[model samples]
Target: MQEAEDLFPAPAPAPAPAPAPTPARDHSAAGHRARLRERLLTGGPDALADYELLEFLLFAGSSRADTKPAAKALIARFGSFAAVLEANPLAVQEVKGVGEAGAAALKSVSLAARRMAKGKVKGQPVLASWQALLDYLAIDMANLNRERVRVLYLNTQNRLILDEIVHDGTIDEGAIYPREVIHKALDIGASALLLVHNHPSGSPEPSRADIAITKKIMEAGRNLGITVHDHVIIGADGHVSLRAKGLI
Candidate 1:
């Protein structure tokens, strides 16, 4: 079968399959994240270092590069993990690699911890759960940059009813009125009061004016039949109870 020899040429060979394109960035850190999570789950809370805890926090907040560097930087800047959580959101955001979302994540943890501490006081005797109350208040007011006055109103059972900010600046300078404070308590049907204020200077010790003004508030509440439980001064150092100090 003498076909024309030149007519039929061999079919062209198929193009070689393209090799799989390589990923530009390494995903080894994801494996590290998994390991950290496992360590957290199996080794208990204290297993992870401060930097590692911070790193885990950044995972849900940031979509950038490896969070280890950010975590390390945060620890270095704030000096500790607790300090990092206690820091102001603006201050936290000022750290490189920690954006607004990351800062919010940190602050949300702080709020969650405070809420958990608060739960320890809720539905329980406030006097009996003093330490838990202190923990809650410390989380809330310890790291403030300016003095603030808050009032914790309680029912007859000594359970917290309302947490109100009565003053925003220096307690001595603020126009804190005892009549208004008593009226608020009366309006809310609160039978007791726990005065709270923060010291920016980190000293929980009460000043002379602090004692004097507290006495005034106590006297005002006394006439109104509302028991003033305690005036707790919160600071970075700790909290002080004026009643414990014999000041009110």
Candidate 2:
């Protein structure tokens, strides 16, 4: 008593027509990335141009997207790889195609370079390696768009025990508390302190405010048995030492 339509069942709906095979995934960028990696590994420091180096860093962020455009955009926007790295993470992301990941990658390199340069001077007598210390400071503070104060605390042996960034300020002005500067030295048992800061104006010359603060810190440290060895003002072209100029 089954109906004829029920008996036939429409021939299984013609097997639902097998879904067309998905097109093969594109591997062109992957191939290029592999070649670039090989070249980087084999070639020396000159292996890649600035943009290419940026591409290498961006690859860490994006797996499938082509990084070349991002790299080029960053270089064009920031002017150089070092400038790109020095930029604030937020600023770096202003470029098209670069997100937080890309910005972080660039920052990691910047931090690594700073640590490496610092290692050359750390644990060594900072005064004896005066040029090395200068090099480290310049690398760290030269490109800053605002003022930042770093205090290098040295034990009685004149070896660096601590390097701390104490304060950051606007493009044209900054402040550091004399009591706090001395308190940190006393707390760390540092016999001497080397103060460092950068000028956003590209000049290492000390302002009246800079001299006033340096003297105040020195006076505060004098009573506490901590010596203010120098206050170095870092700039793009050169550095000035308060002690060298007989200001402190």
Q: Which candidate is the best by TM-score?
A: 1
lDDT of 1: 0.85
Candidates in order, TM-scores: namely 0.80, 0.76
Measured by TM-score, how close is model 2 to the native structure? 0.76
In candidate 2, position 60 carries an lDDT of 83
lDDT of 1 by residue, 64-107 (tens): 45889889999898766777998878988888888888998898
Report lDDT (CA) for all predictions: 0.85, 0.89
Candidate 2 lDDT by residue in tens digits, 1-248: 99999887775445567889998754799977887898899999999888988998999888878999999988888766777888899989888888999889899999999998989998899999999999899888888889999899999889999999998888976778898889989898999999999997889999999999999999989897999899999987699999999987
Q: TM-score of the candidate numbered 1?
A: 0.80
Clashes of 1: 0
For the record, the alpha-carbon RMSD of candidate 1 to the native fold, in angstroms, is: 10.5
* Segments of candidate 2 deviating more than 4 angstroms: 1-35, 245-247
Instruction: Kindly give the stretch of ten consecutive residues in candidate 1 with the minimal lDDT sum.
Output: 168-177
